[model samples]
Target chain A: MAEILARTVEVTRKYGDVTALDQVSLDIRAGEVVGLLGPNGAGKSTLVNLFAGLRKPTSGRVELLGGSPTDPARRRGIGVTPQETGLPPTLRVGECADFVAAHFPDPVGRGELLDRFGLGDLAKRQIGGLSGGQKRRLAVALAFIGRPRLVFLDEPTTGLDVEARRTLWDGIRRFHAEGGTVVLTSHYLEEIEALAERVVVIGGGRVLTDDTMDAVRGLVGIRRVTLTASGLPELTGVLGVEQEGTRTHLLTADSDALVRELVLSGAPFADLEIRPTSLEEAFLTITGRESQAA
Target chain B: MSLVLTHARYQFLETVRVPIAVIGSAFFPAMAMLFFVVPFAGDNAVASTYATGSMVIFAVMSACLFTYGIGVAEDRAQPWDPYLRTLPAGPVPRFTGRIITVMGLTLIAIIPVLVIAAVLTEATVTVPQLLLGLGAILVGSLPFTLMGLSIGYTFSSKAAIVIAQVVFFPTAVGGGLLTGDPAYAPEFIKIVSPYLPTRGAVELVWAATTDFTPNPLALIMLAVWVVVFAALAVWAYRRDEGRRFT
Candidate 1:
């Protein structure tokens, strides 16, 4: 059992009559990458702010490293990349990283962190001159410069191109592999699916689901299965099924059972394939409908 | 302590980068003193008095208004406020840092301003009185600094600028900048002027040249205003904190 790096208990924040975050509680363990998936205004930013100690919860408690988030010692072990682009525009990329590094007692070498993030060439360039994706990359590099045990990244790859996004995704996976815990909130479900081991879906200031990536996908059921067969066996218990000529395509949670039943039915099949449900389908199933109504 | 020093160093460096602040603090006062030398060269009384008084008052205004007002406003404009709050040092160290920077800048500017004022305007003052005036000017500026901070926190940039202008110029004029004779002013003006920051500064400056003494009640009133503005600033900060997380 890994130690919990961050935890929240019934934390609620209200702005006058409006509740930005309702009684929300979550636990993120060490060396784990938890993806926070939600639409805009799903209280994801609010939760990140709470964990960062940028704002105190109106009710309940939040703990980072088993202490108040405001504790300097606790904060030293935590890194954050906010949703808003926070690097000073006038500062150079290296200067911005140095400024954040100064906050920690011991920080990783500037050259090493910059090189890891593919920002070594742009180190001396002013932040104002960088493209949006470059700035975001710089922000991520700064967040990791401290070598913090836990990191909170909110929309970390918002402005990145496809290639840059993949590069960041690889960096995040490597960070998690190195035993650093990361809690990330992003609109890119594919990115989350690629990097995060667990997905925590939030909507309207509430957690819709928190489970492993495979479990979350299972909740939405497998999308499609293609098999060439003379006659399709009955799939009454299966979720959805379709047949065309000698080919049968079925959507079911139990693809193995369906395949076995087809084999037992003595159907001639040339190609057999089962496509697992993606994180996008699961996210849509959980949050898409409610967000549309809201 | 290191955190406070670091913040103060950054703040002071930032202020020095501003051309307006540099001109207003160091240049304007020196220019004002130059006028005293030309217009009242023969009369030592007016020239000496105006030289020391105007220079000191200007220095105080620069620290209180430019340093605290503009500095606080810019800090609020940045993500620094939230960033600082999240840090272990918290707002207290950051606020203390700004005050330390303001005081240091004010002290450093005073030396050159007074030296230039004395040399150009042939201003003369006793060593004891000069030291006393320095203490008085620093203390008197507190209320205005607090007021600037209150305005900085309570209002947006446009509103704060308008209010600062509306209050600063009129108060500077009516509080004995153009005229040394407080008795010559209207009764209501005299009563109101005494409580203004300009009046405290002028009185402190006047105390350096002649045998004039500051009104104890007026100083008390200024102190009361400082307390009030400080309270208001604290309240505004708390309200802003509540809004941020909420």
Candidate 2:
């Protein structure tokens, strides 16, 4: 069996009245690229931060390299690129790489690291002078400086252009080819579809689904329910809810139970529309026996 | 050692590349020496020597406060800061490295002030006393360094800048840096100066270079400030970490 690189056991993180991550457990074994898929405020970053040892769980254990998440020694085999980092504006690109490289026992050479990230040309330029894409590339490149066994990238390509995003995909592929484990979070499902073999989907601080990339896509056939309601009521059997202006788009696989419960709640309401057409396509695709459900 | 030097080296390169930063910290003490002490005190050996001591204290204070206080706050806002904090080495290597860089820059920063004092004034000190004065300047600077740490950790970049200024000016004026002679110190300052660390800091500098006798109360207050600020710095660090990451 492959060794586990990092995992959280029944982890729940709370920030005062808000529970960011519910009782969530995840295991990342070596040589696997696991994509954490979630929308905004979905506890994806919280779990990633736990695995990276940046935060402690309120009621559970987070382990890295079979040791305490807080222990610095456990970080020897790990690397992380947070969602945003302001590089020292004055340091040269090469110098920034070298400064981080100095912390490791056997670091990749500065020149080679720059080459690996396609940052060779910008090596001598100060970080303040680099463009946004270049800065993002550099931030991601620093994670691989120590040849870490596992890397956690939080929204690594949120702002990169298509070409730059592809370039980064190539870099990630090369690392995976060398037998490195990667766990990354992203809002873009296409990014996950392109890069991940396995995936974890989070919503409302809970792991809604965890499976292989193909399996995860095949896991749910959700009906998008749109409703005009004055306020949110206690929800039951609803997958998730998205609020925009005066309308709410609700996602669920079971709409009959959801609609019954919504009507029973006795809240002030108006125009109500339930989307079963999209679900018909998904439900058919999942059942394997083709039917003209749409 | 190499790790520490590596951090220090980059920090040095970063600061020096911005000429304004060097000019900004180095200018005030030298200007004070030029405008405040050169004409009035240059004719007398005792007066000029003590004045130079006060200015030296001023230079060290500026370096430590801005370098650690504002520098740490600025770094706190950076992605690189959290990345470094997460490394297996913890924060010791980087912290030591930054401190070393600050010490080095502080040394280089005061050279202009010392040069002006040497050429334009009759500030005379034996080689041993000068070395001791330099040593005392660094030692007495600990409280201000801690104060800067607290301020940096407690505030954002813009807020840090404002808070540092608000702390810097009053402490300088209240502690006796702007006033050349302690004997000629104003009444309000005389009462409150002994309670401020800067007053204690300048006294130690003066004592190191001249026949000045520092008040026992000033030294005690310096110690109190050091302990309090040190605690506050650590608290601010923990508070930042808890609020942002954990």
Candidate 3:
């Protein structure tokens, strides 16, 4: 197994009466892309903060690179781009990059970093003059400036357009391709699909599932079985049911088994259609189940 | 040392890029010289020389207080500061760099007053005396710098602005900076000046530039203020860090 770069051992964090993370344990190893997927307030940012040494866990331990997260020497091995940031608006892009670079022992060259993020031409411009998308690209690009072993990005592409988001992703991918570890949080499932090999689903400050991408997709393998039928008896293995006039839609995990049962029941169905559910609907199904269970 | 210098250069560049920041620090003291010293005491060698010393201290006080107090508070409110804090290098280098930048701006701020005195007023000093006075001004500005840092770390930028203003004017007036000579100062000021840090700071400036003897009580009080403000500044810093990060 790759060396464990960062770990939280049954960590819990709270803000007064609100619990941000609840007895959560996770390990980030070298040379892997881990995606933290959740809704708005599901402790993703809290976990990132703990690992980055920005905040301490209320209970339990957080270790980064085999030492305390708050130690400066240990923190030198990791880079982080918070969900929101404000760079010095008056400084030129190259100047801001150089200022941050001087703090590291070995930093990426400003020119190479700018070009990698597709921001080569904006080097001379003041940050105040850049568009919001351009500024966000710069913010994410700064995380790679120190050539850190591990990078934590909290919603790295929150306010970016499609083209800009892709540019940012390419920069991140180049780093990971060079054997760097990445842990990113995003509500955009497509982003996780495009980038992460491993996914951790978080809800209500607890880890719901942690598995490989294919496994997660297979686990929530919900299919929409729609048919034009009426006066049918209750169906087996249907997780959810919806109706639109003469058509009935049944959400089922095993479409093959549901179809066989329907045929055996002799429901006299016509125009039978079975389509795979999009990842978005499947994710909603999981979270919806979680909320109902809670 | 190189890292500290780099931080100082960037911080200085960041401040100077906004022309108004430097201009604001230079404006009040220069204006005070023009209105108070040049017209009224320009012909009197002794009066103009003493007023020039007071205005130089005034410039240093303004530069240290506003730059450290308001500048630091404003920086705290920004995301850039927290990001910088997360870096491996400790806060010492950045803190030293910011102080150096403020000292540079303070030197720049005193220039207009010196120029106005040299050209229009009868203020004069030998080369060694002038250098000594410059050194004294930097040393004397420490108390105000610490005071500024305390307010900065303890309050938001909005509140720091009002607090700095409230703290500045009385110290300037009550310390006898407005009076042309300490002997000619109001009776109330004479009694109160020894306790204000500004009095000791200006007295050191006067002693450096002229044959005047600084009051021992004022110098002792100045040292006390430095210690007091230093303690307060450190407490404020740790309090802020605990509340925000821990």
Which of the numbered candidates is closest to the native, going by highest DockQ? Answer: 2
**Which pairs clash (backbone N, Cα, C closer than 3 Å) in model 2?**
A85-B79, A86-B79
- Candidates' interface RMSDs, in order? 2.7, 2.0, 2.0
Task: Supply DockQ values for each candidate.
Answer: 0.23, 0.53, 0.41
Candidate 1 Cα errors over 4 Å, as ranges: A82-84, A92-95, A119-126, A162-167, A218-285, A288-294, B17-21, B24-52, B104-122, B125-136, B170-178, B181-189, B205-212, B242-246
Please list the residue runs of candidate 2 whose C-alpha ends up more than 4 Å from where it truly belongs after superposition.
Answer: A82-85, A220-294, B184-191, B213-217
Q: How many angstroms is residue A177 displaced in model 1 relative to the true structure, after the best TM-score fit?
A: 2.6
| Cα error, candidate 2, residue A205 (Å) | 1.4
The reply for model 3, stretches above 4 Å from the true place, is A82-85, A218-294, B242-246
Kindly list the per-residue Cα lDDT of model 2 for residues B78-142, writing each as its tens digit.
Answer: 76676776777765576667777777777787898889888998888888888988888777888
Candidate 1 chain A, run of 10 with poorest lDDT: A277-286
Ranking of all predicted structures according to DockQ, beginning with the best and ending with the worst: 2, 3, 1
lDDT score at residue A12, model 2, on the 0-100 scale:
90
lDDT of 2 by residue, A1-294 (tens): 899888888999999989999889888999999998766677887787777666778898888999986788888788887433478888889988888888788888999889988899999898888888888998898889988999988778877999999999999999999999999887766788888999887776777668998887666546778888879688886656678899988777788888888888888777888775342233333332212221
Question: What order do candidates take by TM-score, descending?
Answer: 3, 2, 1
User: Per-candidate RMSD vs. true structure?
Assistant: 7.4, 6.6, 4.6
User: How high is each candidate's TM-score?
Assistant: 0.77, 0.84, 0.86
**B154-202 per-residue lDDT for model 3 (tens digits):** 9989999999999999999899898888889899999999999999999
Candidate 1: residue A241 Cα off by (Å) = 22
